[model samples]
Target chain A: DQQVKQNSPSLSVQEGRISILNCDYTNSMFDYFLWYKKYPAEGPTFLISISSIKDKNEDGRFTVFLNKSAKHLSLHIVPSQPGDSAVYFCAASALPNYGQNFVFGPGTRLSVLP
Target chain B: DVKVTQSSRYLVKRTGEKVFLECVQDMDHENMFWYRQDPGLGLRLIYFSYDVKMKEKGDIPEGYSVSREKKERFSLILESASTNQTSMYLCASIPGQGASGANVLTFGAGSRLTVL
Candidate 1:
């Protein structure tokens, strides 16, 4: 079962524009959500995260918004740059203990046009 | 910076050949994981070790096995590699500190393997 899903496989946006990526989860037990960015031939790097307790978390150019009711979350990048072009993955974990089962979405490849 | 290193960045092997992929973490993490990344499939966990000499099968463990004799090193072995096993394999680590109940994963560059 695909607990986490990224409906869009690819997206493109103009440089300096806002970029939005969406993710949905079927497991309501998951309370911690994270986003990772990956470049070609490289490992995934952590970008931002949000807890189910809050609706939104912001860090400079990146912001993550969580809607528990909808079982959905989104990552928003303002002033998107060419460097932001990469595959973004959304992951979720229950976090009930130290070592919890984590699940990842299929991932969305974003292309920022210069 | 926490470093999770995968010994091989790329490898090619023939079908029915035994293959081994090594991973090491410098940060003394108690939890380590192995995953395979494929197009449209994302990352699927193959195995994970929570402690030295301890291992657990992840979502997809068929045709693969792993060993964690030491805390810092985790190895994935393919008894007999098959063409379908060709894909990008990733290793990740998580500190046991369990500081704030966070399950953040530190990943390595990944190993791309091809089975002919």
Candidate 2:
């Protein structure tokens, strides 16, 4: 069973526009969420994360919003750049367990056209 | 900067051959993990070690084993390689202390294994 899901396989956006990637989770015990970006032939790199206590977390042009009631979370990049083109993965984990095991979604490929 | 290094970037092996993938971390992190990445499968955990000589199986642990003789190094072994086992392997490490849930993981460049 897929506890975490990223329905969108691909997304395209023009530069200077906002890009949004969405993710959903079925496990209620998951309280921590994270986003990672990966390039071709490379391992994924951590991007941003949000705790269950907060609804939104922002760093620079990247923002993550979590809706506990909806069991959904999203990553938003304002003024998307060509360098932002990469596959984004959403991962979720429960508290107390910490890094024991993190469930990852299928990932969304984002393409930014310059 | 915390750096995680994998022993090989690419490897080709025959079916039923024994395969080994090595990972080393310089950050002195206590937690180490192994994962495989495939198209449409994202990253599936194969095994993890919390400390030296400790290991635990992850989501997909079949046909795989792990060894953690030292805190900085973790190894993944395939007793008998199969065609379906060919995939990109990733090694990650996170600090054991000073983080609540889901600390960010630093990953290596990844090792691609192809079994014929």
Interface root-mean-square deviation (Å) of every model: 1.8, 1.6
- Per-residue lDDT, model 2, residue B11, is 99
| Candidate lDDT values, in order | 0.93, 0.93
Candidate 1 per-residue lDDT over residues B52-103, each given as its tens digit? 9999999999999999999999999999999999999999988775453247
Model 1 alpha-carbon drift over 4 Å, by segment? A97-100, B100-102
Q: Under the 3 Å rule for N, CA and C atoms, how many clashes does model 1 have?
A: 0
Q: Estimate each model's TM-score.
A: 0.97, 0.97
The sequence of per-residue lDDT tens digits that candidate 2 reaches over residues A1-114 is 899999999999999999999999999999999999999888899999998999999999999999999999999999899999999999998865536678999899999999
Runs of candidate 2 with Cα error greater than 4 angstroms are B99-102
Name the TM-score of chain A in model 2: 0.97
lDDT score for residue B45 of model 1 = 93
Score candidate 1 by TM-score against the native: 0.97
